[model samples]
Target: MCGIAGYIDYTGKAGDTELKKMTDALSYRGPDASGQEVFSLNNATLGLGHRRLSIIDLSPLGKQPMFTPDRSLSIIFNGEIYNYREIREELSAKGHAFISGSDTEVILHAYQQWGDECVKKFTGMFAFAIFDEEKQELFLSRDRAGVKPLYYYQHNGCFLFASELKAFFTYPGFEKAIDPQAFRLYVQYTFVPAPYTIFKHTWKLEPGCSMRVDLKSGNIAQQRYWDVLDYYGQPKQKIGDAEAKEALRQRLIKACEYRMVSDVPVGMFLSGGYDSSLVTALLQSGRSEKIKTFTIGFTDAKYNEAQHAAKVAAHLGTDHHELYCSFDDAKAIIPELPECYDEPFADSSAIPTMLVSRFARKQVTVALSADGGDELFAGYERHAALLGIAAKKDKIPAALRPLAATVLRNTPKTVLNKIFSGNTSADNLAKYLDFLQGKTDLADMIDFANQTAAPDTLAGLFTQAASPGVLFRKNEIRKLPGRLDQLLAFDYLSYLPGDILTKVDRATMHISLEGREPLLDHSLIEWIATLPDEMKYRNGVSKYLLRQIVHDYLPREIMERPKMGFSIPLVNWFRSDLRPLFDEHLSEKSLAAHGLLDHKQVAKLLHEYYSGDNYRFTLLWTLLMFQLWYKKWMQ
Candidate 1:
């Protein structure tokens, strides 16, 4: 894993010092080594820079800006091709020669042989840039699932790209004002989605897509190269229970085995959950050498999974490490949030992710995580409960629907809170939607300065749900399983990428440790997508099939335990240790100084929450994150 940044100066006047500054901003991502390459072609310069973390081949031969044997194509890559060895053998048999035993070399050779179609054969997470020297064209692509990020800025015939938004800021002519549409979406979704960033001129490349920029004409074209729907639409086949179990076992083992092909020592992040435990078990089962496992614990038992992780590690006979996080630790990291996330991000779990990655980096160079399990296998409690409530709502008489909604609307907040008990359901859909509105309604959220281009986040969500062609399989699948599958699929498409992956990437890269996700392997995801919903969630249980598969290698006691997420005691912290900071940062004066939020509304929320009239901790934290981010990046 590494960081890549570069520019194609169509104006033909940019200097190497500019490229150096861009690469220098990403130093935290690749502390092992750095390199830059420049080529002058057709009165323009193509500058490429790379920061290497040195995972696969820890030698100078593996340094990037790697070129084909003829040096016709040059490339800089930022992710691992887990199946590169297999691809390398096939290419070698087909008469391709390689100079190094590195996945970067495989990509360079594969691109030379297959052109843009080479992306179809790749089976790992990657975001890369390849320059076709003869054609004077730049080809940029992101992985199928967007496990990594790539941001680019195009202005005045100059195209600059980087692994992080911070790199773009290093350019002398780059602008820094926040994009209003992006800020509105950040308030609503808690993170800016693809094709939009906090900066007006910058955009994120969508997953499964590639972009090509022509130097002479300054024309940019982007096209989707892969679709998850193609795999989902295949005819279903039934396998016996034994056969299914064995197939799952083989796929997981292969996934783990492939990720273990690193030069440095590797470890697993064991959260004591079924997903992480399964990964730990499989890695132990296949290897003779001891594997290291890491976990973070909180003093509050409700938030602590270290004991469980320790138990699993002991059972698996691995070298285990645990770190106890206190309020001080959380406080120490809060000020560094803006540096970790280049844009305004509000996921609090980022704290634990960073702490764990910091702990893991001390013991291992590479670490594996089980991040995509929940989204792929229906592992969230919300999915099952939403389905059940929607089913019950469907059965209610049409004449009673309005009456029921009226009653729910008139019901006292206290009574409704008691009845639903914090579960977001159709019965309380209006309130939940209100909560998600985040400070303002859709119409009011748009900036007056750019009324012609009012932000349409809700429209974007519907467009995503109703996307045309093969990608619409998610919309079709939603029709089959009540509205819950739609919610889950939306989470898979949006939250999994926007929040979870962002949290992991920043945390792991900040410590210069490469983190890989075996469960997120695209093949396994495609296979799970084809399975019947019943196999995923049976009898109100989430991830039923996954639990059964895990039981094969772990005790029932460990498999049956309740899920404990990597969470902090935000409620307690707000009420105690973080109270002063929260008040100071979210005060009316602070909100007014920011000028993006309405001070009156902010004061109302603070008063209501502190006076025990409302539970608005989540909203407050979102505001706090935005405030801090603005202070760090904009001001």
Candidate 2:
């Protein structure tokens, strides 16, 4: 629950002044305290800076740049190691003495005892940097589920790492060149995928990864310390449904309780969906203290779930808070999106996410968010629909599939739209055709499911081809025994981290709140990955097992409902309230100045969107977001 910034400056230039500036950029992430330390090396200078929110240890003793007993290893941490007490006991038995009741101390000592292997023994959300004084190297690790963010820039013998990309803006002589490949992917995926930032030479450390940078040789080596594939690759567990349900219940209970490890008051972001309801039910079942629950309701009824959440809160008898946000509340947050994310992010739901975080921050410092449930347990409707699509694709004769796709492809857009009731776009049709023609892969299907634009549309819009950053990692996915497993695996790697986790981390940290993903406790997902696919999605029910467990605590009517995701009315707003922003950001002057997008193509899209085309809202928002970010950070 903090912000950390550090660098190995081989040129011996940057020191306390630069480090302080870097840390200052993230001051909101840790408003409670701040610290900066610089160490002179053989021919370089290494510095570590921290902004602390004081979640676990509220005392000054928990201040970071914390060191081991011998001071051989210094560390700056950005998340909670939920199992710190257990690890502390283990370390104490191994003759380690701790001076503070902070997970930061436990991490430093753990690294001292286990070297790079320390990440394997921990269970929590974390992105940390440990400066090994003796080795003259920096060891960096991100949590397995990617709940916390860690970004780094490396080139020309200097290595810079931080908890957020904003910190890099303060470093001396740091280049701000954009990566065109990443931009095209951003246009295609609506968020830059990991290992690739919006900037050249900068990258988000992949989840389940640890990197070591050697000061003397300036050699950087990164290794995957953990991966979902390890679990997905295993044979499906043959356990019965009864045993599986009980096992899952026990795991869910443990995961939710573990996230309650905090000195500060904690709450739940209860959306009243299956995921959040289950977390609330499990955590509030035995607790004497009522858990504070927060929900953001839209004034628009179609998007509002506050009433459902209120029912759950009433049923559970927990303290609940709800805010009904108008268009003004959401629209006011748009101008700040570029700064909040610090990247060209296009998740419009971020507005409400930020609102909830701000509302909850008044009463709690730590809030448990149920984010990984969909990816881990087949909760999304698309998961079931895509499996259906695959089944239908399998049933159609492979030879006739190509003919069918050809006939559909040859049809005029207007006729196709008429046939599909104006709900299908050319991009959607292209992807569906690819699937029928056997040209679509798992990643492409995922892109179709989550895309803001179609492949053909993006190709026409961008000057460069989108890079298949992580989407092309199909060898392992192809080996999965079921389409559902493949879809889940690809999502865990791409969408979960690239969009979902990124959205939560940035939105929460922007408001200085520690958002914990209890459902994403790596162990829970690992176990879920082992169970048969049917256990998760069966008989047209998504999250079958999860629904069963939730039903035990909540009545069927209260918990079973269509998943209304955290969303804004972008369709109407883009035409009315947000039209000015779209015009301002996508003006000809702005597009011509950037020279990365086709002005004519953008104009065509804009014209269609303004002329009663609501489906283009996703792509339009993507463009507007990129333009906003480009003007802020690049220009």
Candidate 3:
């Protein structure tokens, strides 16, 4: 894994100075070594810079801007190619020779032999840019799940790209103007969605995509190399439940086995959740030596999961390490979030993820995260709630459904909250009603369910129109019959990559730690996506089949417990340990200076929180995160 930065200056004004700064800014992402290169041709300059973490080959030969023997193609890559050894053996048989035992060299040869087709053959997370000197082109590609991030900024004919958004700020001419639409979107979604960044001209390259930029003509061609829908859109599983379970077990073992390839020490982030527990079980089953496991806990009982993690670790006989953080330790990390994320991100779980990554980094260079399991296998409470609402909504006539939805939307949020105080079903009702306003369907409902701020809330903040979320723009889940499939597909396409993966990537990368997700292996995802929805969730239980598989290695008593997320006590902290930050960030002066939020609405949110309706935490955190980011970047 590494960090890459580069620029293609159409006017030849770009040089090594800016390239050095861009690459240097990302040194935290790759603390092992660094390199920079520049080429001038056709009144244009092409520069590539890399910060190497040195996972595969520890020697100097693994240094990048890696190139083929002829030096016609050079690549700056960030991520592991888990199947590189297999690909290397294939290349060697085809008369291709490699100089070092490195995945970077394998990628260079793969590109040399197969051209753009090389990306389709890769099975691991990656975001890379390759410069083809002979063709005078720059090829960029992100892995299928967007496990890695690639951000780019284009203005005045200068194109710059980096692994993190902050690298763009290193360019002297780069503008700091915020994209207003994207800003409002960030407030609503808690993270800027793909194809849009905080800045107008900057963009996030979507997952499973590749682009070829003609250096001479400056024409860019972009396309998707793979799609999860291609597999999920197929008919449901024809095999029996037992067969599906066995198939899943084998695929997971293979994925974990391949991800274990590295020259550095590796470990697992064992949250004691179904996903992480399963990963740990598979990893420990075959090995004689214990694998390292790390978990982060809180002093407060409600927010801590370390006990469960410890129990799981003891049962598995692994080397478990944990840190129970005080509220002050978490609060101390708050000020650095603006720099740590380099974008507006408000997922509260990032706190624990950050602490856990730091804890693991002390012992291991690479750690596996169980991120995609929830989205793949219907593991969230919201999924079950949405399905239940869909069933009831199906009973309503299509003609009258819109009117009923309008009535629900017209109801005051405060009135609903008052009547259903702390009732999860009522919250689901509100979400379903909000979803019903515009489009009364499974796909539209899925989009509405993920919002942190409603349209009325956004309108009160922004001067211009805040367009509806881009999620329901099209029905990509045509073959997904029930609510579960549609919700899964939406979360996979939107939430998983946009918010969840983004949170994990930023947190882990900030500490120069590599995080792998075995559960997210495309092979396993495709296999699970094709299975029946009941296999994933049944009898009011999420991940039912997953639980059965996990039971083989763990006792039923240990595996059966209420689902607890790696979440922090945000509302309590906001009112206590972080009260000063909350007051300062949302004070009238701060609100007035920011000018993107309505003072009255902000006051109302504050009232709700102080009056014991702590449910406003999500919206409050969303505003605080956006406000913090605005001052740090836009100002």
Winner by lDDT: 2
Weakest 10 consecutive residues, lDDT, candidate 1?
Answer: 443-452
Candidate 3 lDDT at 90 equals 94
Candidate 2 per-residue C-alpha lDDT over 203-309 given as tens digits, one digit per residue, 9 for 90 to 100? 99999999998887888899999989889888889999999999999999999889998898999999999999999999999888999999999888899999999
Report clash pairs, candidate 3: none
lDDT of 2: 0.88
- lDDT tens readout by residue for model 1, 255-321: 8988998889899999999999998999999667888999999999999999999988988898999
Local accuracy of candidate 3 as per-residue lDDT tens digits, 195-234 = 7888888989999999888988888899999988887778
Candidate 2's TM-score reads 0.97
In TM-score terms, candidate 3 sits at 0.95
lDDT of 3: 0.85
Question: Which of the predicted structures, 1 or 2, would earn the higher lDDT when compared with the native?
Answer: 2
Which residues of candidate 1, in runs, are more than 4 Å off?
A: 412-421, 424-485, 613-615
Backbone clashes in each candidate structure, one number apiece?
Answer: 0, 0, 0
Clashing pairs in 2: none
Ranking by lDDT: 2, 3, 1
Off by more than 4 A, model 2: 407-423, 464-472
For every model shown, what is its TM-score relative to the native structure? Answer: 0.91, 0.97, 0.95
Better of 1 and 3 by lDDT: 3
